[model samples]
Target: MEIEFFDILSKNGPVSWSPNTVKTRLCLNYLAIPHKTTYLSYPDIAKNHKSLGIPPNPKGLEFTCPAIAVKQSSKVFALQESLAIAKFLDETNSSNSDRKIFPNPGALSLALLVQRVVDRILNSPVAKIAIPKVVDILDPSGREYFIRTRTEWFGMPIDDWAGDLEIAWKNLARDVDIFSKMLVEAANGPEGGPFFMGSVPSYADFVFVGYIVWLKEANEADGESNG
Candidate 1:
């Protein structure tokens, strides 16, 4: 149970700010793992992670948060990426093995499939709406890093990311309609409702909810900023 959860900090605090970190938080909640969360600014992620001896990511950014340092007996190992971390938590479920994320072997595939679909279809439109407001939620350090990276990533400034609110909202609604139809098709039985897998929530639910939580929060921040 000796674990340290690293997450990005925003002005709104550390509970459920960043979508990626929120996914980790959801997985941790699902596992009921006791861990202390350590907040870091955007610039601090690379600095602190390298100092911590956490290896760079194989694919994208070398260092990122929503990471965990798990200690067993004498050795400490670090893990990053929300889905990979979820798999780890599932494997290490010593307490409630029956109540699990991967109820069957095929569930892992399902979760991965759902995650891919979420990343492809929903991430951009939602992120387009969320990123600008997210900048308002960060302190100077995090804000600066967020703006620079996002500007390069999006090929435009933060303000321009959500420049046309009317158009952005319309586009978002269209994407959401497509996504909702997906959920409807999956809702086959009485067990189905909010979750992708009916009443039984899974990692896929957490993955989809992570983006949505941030979107909702970002819109809240947008309103607060306007007022």
Candidate 2:
């Protein structure tokens, strides 16, 4: 069955600026799943999810995007949370072993570890900078919704969050540098340049890619070179 995937819409359309949503999109792409994406704005996410019997995030927000609904013989399973959804997709579509996201038994734990560390070191700082810039590409209500909600989320206004853009980038670079050294030493790169596990792709690598995409979007929005 084709999965009904939900993604938050930007002003530009179906391409979401949210890293979590983009992460799931990449997961779906990697797995080559048959899924149709439905893009919604910020205000519409909760309504759409709730209408589909999707539960609110336990400890995070009231609702989250990047949800998927799959219909089986007798049930329609609606799942949220990118990592959980990724696990489900991998488990269900892993008949072709080589196409699996988790290459080995330890890959799951490593993915989780990378997910946590990257969220802190990379996502946190990047959000401070990239998140506000996303408003430029959102609809009017979405713009307001993002500002208000994210302000509360960050405990500061959007401008204040990235008040010193220089510091925001500096923090990202410093923490990412530290994490890079640690990650490299812990898991040495292979002959094909660099990745979390060398040449092989993993969910952990997608986590990094998601953040990179978000940063790139922000960079483009700011009319600044990534350099």
Candidate 3:
């Protein structure tokens, strides 16, 4: 059965630019799952999810992207949240044991920690650099909604918040340096491992990979080089 992967559409249409969705996509790819994508415009998110009968998030979010609908035994099951979706895929695909996102008992805990660190420490600076660029990539309604919501959330206009690009880049560099050191310390088993858990990629790797993907796209959109 094919799974329905719901992802956000970019302003130009049919293109996706969401990090959370990318995380779930990576998990599905790793598991070799057969899936089709449904792109949702920002304005259609709440209406579409509601029409599809998806439940509200426990965090009180009315709607979110990266939802999946899977068909089994002639019944359809829908799920939300990137990490939860990844965990479900890992648990359901028992034969693909080697492709598990969480490979050990302590893996989930450590992955959650890494996710928290990225979200809490690194995301803000990155957002300061990225949001201004993101506005141009969103559709008209999406751009309006994004600007209003984000401006309200940040207690200032996105342009104003992102005004100090130099400081934001410096802060991002500093936090990235800290993360680089942590990655080095975490690497104990191999001579050339690119992931947090030595040579093997885990949920922690996916978490940061999502962020990196977002950063890369944002930089590209801004006509800036990641280097």
Candidate 4:
């Protein structure tokens, strides 16, 4: 049976904004897993997950995007959180041994490091640039929910949180330089390639690719060239 991939979608608009969701999607594609996406609008995310019997996030959030439900034999498994889902898929899908997501013991640690750096550091400025555009494209209800939640989370209005794009852009450039330097140092080792893990794409590559995909979506929304 095919897995059910739950993704956050904008009502009457595109559904590729969430970087976490994109990470799981990239993992699924790289593993050649046969799955189908079930898109949910922002306001409905928590309710939909509850209806499917999925557990709430341990971090106390009501729900998160990028969940997956898989039915194997007589058992059904549902999971939330992008990294957990990706790790699960990589370990469980034994058929694709050659294209393993983790690759090795050290690879998992490296991948987690990259994921953390991107999520905790690089995403701040990117969110400043993208979240406003994302909110503008959502449906009325979704927009309201997003604004309220984000305002609370950021302790300010989303619009004001990203004040001064010039500074944000400069910060983003510095973050990108740091990331590029790390990649270059990694490549300096014996193993090197266009991807994160030598010649083959790994979970690390998917983590970075997710950010790239989000940037692409944001650029398209703003009528800017991603190049």
Candidate 5:
């Protein structure tokens, strides 16, 4: 069974990052789910996303990236939103003979909680500082202002960018505590070794990896701007 995944190769204006798409791919990779990647361009993705059944304002004006279409039982299931898509991949791609993508109820719950934490970090004030700066650095002045103002509306501290940065880092630290706890739990769980659910990486690991990469990219962008 092959799955169709939409992604962007470059960060163009109005084009959303395929964080969820990347997560889905990671899950599929770890779980050994067969899939094909389709690159969606800015022109069609920006203007015709609605027609493609992608929510325009998923996560609040964060255009949906990494939408997936699954083929099953002679029908196709199209999913938008990163976390939901991850869950869908877990449920549908179970081969019945191998270790599951999500495992049992306990693992599913953990995946859900970890994804929630990802949401917090992504929307947090501190994380907001990095992306707009990257966008501003990469885009034209007018587009940069739009990105900055959007960040401002979404908890960016325009008045005290430094103060906001401090608060953002503090919030991230708080969230990281929870993440670390989860990691500890995984380390202590039965059959613990390499992954959150056990020896094999689960859907949660994929989501975790995606966010880690995103944070790293943001930090790199921040350092470049500061330099």
Candidate 6:
């Protein structure tokens, strides 16, 4: 078999708290894909994103830390956005063909629902907590923009910062409850596995794993900052 190669862009030693980045790494690990990580500083990422074809965000064109580059036919395809990258890699590799990482016709509906729930937490409440951390590291002056963007996107009251934090926590708790129930259901299945699809780790597994790490870190930081 020809050796498969991938270039994963990451911060904090290839696998830290960035779920999207970690998702890519975990999926690669699961697939046994040989890869190398290119650790880029903030300045390097900013300078290269446009050439890399990554769209700019408040985080800048670096695409929020965990961008991936896939090598095929001597050309590299750089992908930003976690789910898009995950689905693309899953489909590209044959080892994942039978596994169905992104779900299929039968499970597609449930997968989408799970995806939405995951996205809400990651982009909403989780983002509420994390944007500050990112801004602290990447753009201290842009903190207001981060707050305003999250508030507007999540449709939360602009003045109610404490209220927004509470809402985020409540929303996250509901999601965790739903996930716990699903995990229980999955674990009891005929095949028996800790993944959503019972025997195989699907897209939900990667998505859930990413968020759990983020939520935990955020919670820990909240505790330390207060204490």
lDDT of 3: 0.81
TM-score of each: 0.90, 0.90, 0.91, 0.91, 0.69, 0.67
lDDT of 1 by residue, 102-191 (tens): 776767787788778777877777777788888888879999998899899778888776677667677777777865875786686676
Expressed as tens digits, the lDDT of each residue in 5-96 for candidate 3 is 99987765665567788899888888877789998767788887777688889894668989988888888888788988989888886446
User: lDDT tens digits, residues 17-131, model 5?
Assistant: 3346567667666667777776654344454456556556634654555777777778766766766776676666655437566677787787777778777664464345555
Kindly report which residue pairs in candidate 5 clash with one another.
126-168
RMSD (CA, Å), candidate 5 to true, equals 4.9
Residue-level lDDT of model 4, residues 1-227, one tens digit each, is 55999987765454656788998988888888888888887889888788778988878686898999899898878889988998899888855667888888878898889988987888988888878677766778888888899999889988799898668678888888867876776677577766776666788888887887777676567577635
Residue pairs in collision within model 6: 101-203
Residue 225 lDDT (model 5) = 32
Listed per model in order, the count of residue pairs whose N, CA or C atoms clash below 3 Å is 1, 1, 0, 0, 1, 1
List where candidate 4 sits over 4 angstroms from the true fold.
Answer: 11-15
Among all windows of 10 consecutive residues in model 6, the one with the lowest summed lDDT is: 3-12
Positional deviation of residue 191's Cα in model 2 after best superposition, in angstroms? 7.4
Kindly indicate the candidate among 1 and 5 with the higher TM-score: 1
lDDT of each: 0.80, 0.81, 0.81, 0.81, 0.61, 0.60
lDDT of model 2, residue 44? 92
Candidate 2 clash pair list: 11-137
Query: Against the correct fold, how does model 1 do in TM-score?
Result: 0.90
**Candidate 4 clashes between residue pairs 3 or more apart in a chain or in different chains:** none
TM-score for predicted model 6 compared with the true structure: 0.67
Instruction: Report the poorest 10 consecutive residues by lDDT, candidate 2.
Output: 185-194
Q: What tens digits encode model 2's per-residue C-alpha lDDT throughout 145-219?
A: 988988887798888777778888888888888657745754664435366766667888888778888888776
